[model samples]
Target: MILPPHETQAERDASAARFGAELARLTAAAGLPLPPARRLTWCTAEFEGPPATPAPHHGAEPGPPAPDRARLRGESDRYPPHLTLYRGRLPLAEGRPPDLLPALRAVSAWLAGADLAAIRRTAPFLHVQEWAFTHERTPLDRIELNWRVRMQGLAHGPYPVAREDVKALWEAAFAQPRLRRLRPVTSHYTLWFSSTPDYPFERVGASVEPLHRGGYLVRAGGGEPATVATAAEAVALAVAALPPEPV
Candidate 1:
């Protein structure tokens, strides 16, 4: 598993120091104004992708190791910790907060100057997130409506099923009963990859490509992509992934 950028308070402090310096460097390079205290904050989301790593030249600059793409993307109990482009609730720097997001987006654009899909990904992934239980929870009805694409549902007790059918499988497992407590549910369209020897990327639909991390020029989307872990889980999701209305 990839070690997080700021796994501890001390590490966080160290990271902040380095980023402040790096941001200054970036500002100078771009001829942008620096704020008194530059900070960046991460917004809540279904799941966080990998944190940005400093460029290669920043290797010896004394910072946390970048996450391991392989392990972070693999099935492992140990996951990488996450921090935004900056640290803390407020990303503070001596200089003005640089336009980090725009910078990131700009870099992405520059990297993918022509082919929009060149660095883009559209593979499906199972994102499990916690939700509020406004109502009491119940079990599946055994016979109920199959979920359409992007329907709400949960991961199975045994394991996850095919990525494409995650929605259907989830809806089937927890067919519309009220819930009391919060629990983890599947979030879709979260996982994608370039062609890898271990986990290959195939077309799940129209416009899909065979290349893993297929975007040739630049790669976007950051975060851990956890595939369905076990054999039983795959089978369960596979069964759940069956078509809603049979021909």
Candidate 2:
């Protein structure tokens, strides 16, 4: 990360431009479709509840996705590629260094193209095999729940999942660690978007309407609405909406 001593905003933009251009060039060289970058972050909800999930056996095919179970289940020797989009930022309080997030997103459209599998793959990180995620989700906890929320993003390719298609992966993430219901006014919302595409965006479990000019009119669950200009602003607004934890 560039520190204050080394650069100004203009300098940073120059650096990011150089970085993005090279990254795109190299990505093209690799023969992989250059997709847009989706942003991410960590929070108490994702980090505090569970243990790491184990990897899937090599060559094993996943079973049909179930939606009721509240657990994410899977095994993969490889890290969940989702984390890479966020610079491998895991949802742990004590793992990974504080992110150089601005830099990671500094060069938006670092790659070319418009497909969204990259964003869909990381949706709410449901069922992450923690170990695999940041790079994992267990896959079974909220398959249905996640699908319901991420349906719009993942509804492409051969097996397009419809809202009616939801079936529980598991009923819950953990029985003992029951999630306390929020007092009617409380909720958590997250907004992730790709700056490269100008307007392509995703709301994780929140309802938002896109403005043709730019920005979004976001109304999370039962909360009041707000107009925000960027994914970062949206995340901050959502985090700010959280009711203070009881002291």
Candidate 3:
């Protein structure tokens, strides 16, 4: 398995500072101006316990979190707070003039933290329910920011290739006559075949990895890899290099 990178708390803090600085600069350039009352402000709440149990009747208007439970705070991976954009405000109707989309996007981007795609999608979206602060308050944005922040703190990265994209390739490779007896193991983007069930990383007989532009790269134990144009060719190459099954 590919391990994630490690970082100290101090390092994470520094990264957060850098992210905040860039976000501020980008928001300023987004072209929306607001008064102090309407400007976004970070706010947080601490629940006393495992919710009131039975979770207040459905559709019942929720009250403000206890005053002591609420406070304005800075960014944090745990117990992340939200930025309140407005007080008792209604959403702008569709096609409203002056288009406050920029402000909404800024808030969403802030909440999305390091998730580049989420930030991009928020620009055209006015509100994201998952990230909402409160029903009475402005709709929240970037509900997943806290998780993203934690992942960022841990230096986790998105997978290079989606598993679904390579499912067929693995299936085809496993079907090859010479490779059929070998068990396929995966490590991130790589697929390895080993006769042993344990299949230690170093002992795999053959491995295949997808090339960036378009192709499969096949490698035999510690040997140079050969890039093939198609999955079929890659499977054939790997099968040829694989060791014969035990008697």
Candidate 4:
């Protein structure tokens, strides 16, 4: 997770602790049993770009390094530092009860055996918010899929759910909502995190101009700090090592 340079290690630790505790508390309050928190790998496409312009409070500290302009388009100030693609939350069979490690491992191995050419054909995209001044637009034809593997509790807290039940739930939630709006967007993964504790907003909002140029920003995060993968390469490595699919 990206952090402000100005914060001390103690502050960072404290913040993380608070975040975790609140997460746990909220889950329990929702009447959802907490899933066994374990280390798992996830995959996502990230936008390679420059660090954001810091807020006024950030003036005391030097900002992140500048991005490479040669490889990027438009003004350097046009976009945020990152955008995520697919995110998978790996399930482990141990401490949490229904260990999904075996099934996770199986999926990883299967991915390894499968050809990435098909996957890569759908090169990752950074969805950026558009700005009236920029007059930018995202290409509609790109193939994008955000895949994730996570516990049902983490995905939809307080409400007990299983992998098999996700499709129906999603249809009821997302599909139904979209139908009402007359807009349709297909999602290839499950929604694990609640809309609360809105984080990464700084990073997300910074690229509003670019996002409008693109269609949407795809991002994912999991319960364990050790499990989050920030880069696509790392996610691929984990997927390749995953075991076979569970029966």
Leading candidate by lDDT: 3
* TM-scores, each model vs. reference: 0.22, 0.24, 0.33, 0.19
Question: Candidate 3: minimum summed lDDT over ten consecutive residues — where?
Answer: 88-97
Residue pairs with colliding backbones in model 3 are: 131-140, 132-140
Q: Give stretches of model 3 more than 4 Å off.
A: 1-165, 199-202, 245-247
lDDT of 4 by residue, 101-158 (tens): 2222222322233222322222222221222012112212111111111222223322
Instruction: Please provide, for model 1 over 30-70, each residue's C-alpha lDDT reduced to its tens digit, 9 standing for 90 to 100.
Output: 66433322232121111112443443332122355332111
Ranking by lDDT: 3, 2, 1, 4
lDDT tens readout by residue for model 3, 143-240: 12222222222221111224443655665764575655445556766777655544253344668887767788888876787998877888887777
The window of 10 residues in a row where model 2 has the poorest summed lDDT is: 39-48
> Between the candidate structures 2 and 3, which one is better when assessed by TM-score?
3
- The C-alpha lDDT values of all candidates are 0.26, 0.29, 0.41, 0.25
**Which candidate leads the pack in TM-score?**
3
Please give the lDDT score at residue 133 for candidate 3.
31
Cα misplacement distance, residue 122 of candidate 2 (Å): 24
Which scores higher on TM-score, 1 or 2? Answer: 2
Q: What lDDT score goes with residue 42 in model 2? A: 18
Better of 3 and 4 by TM-score: 3
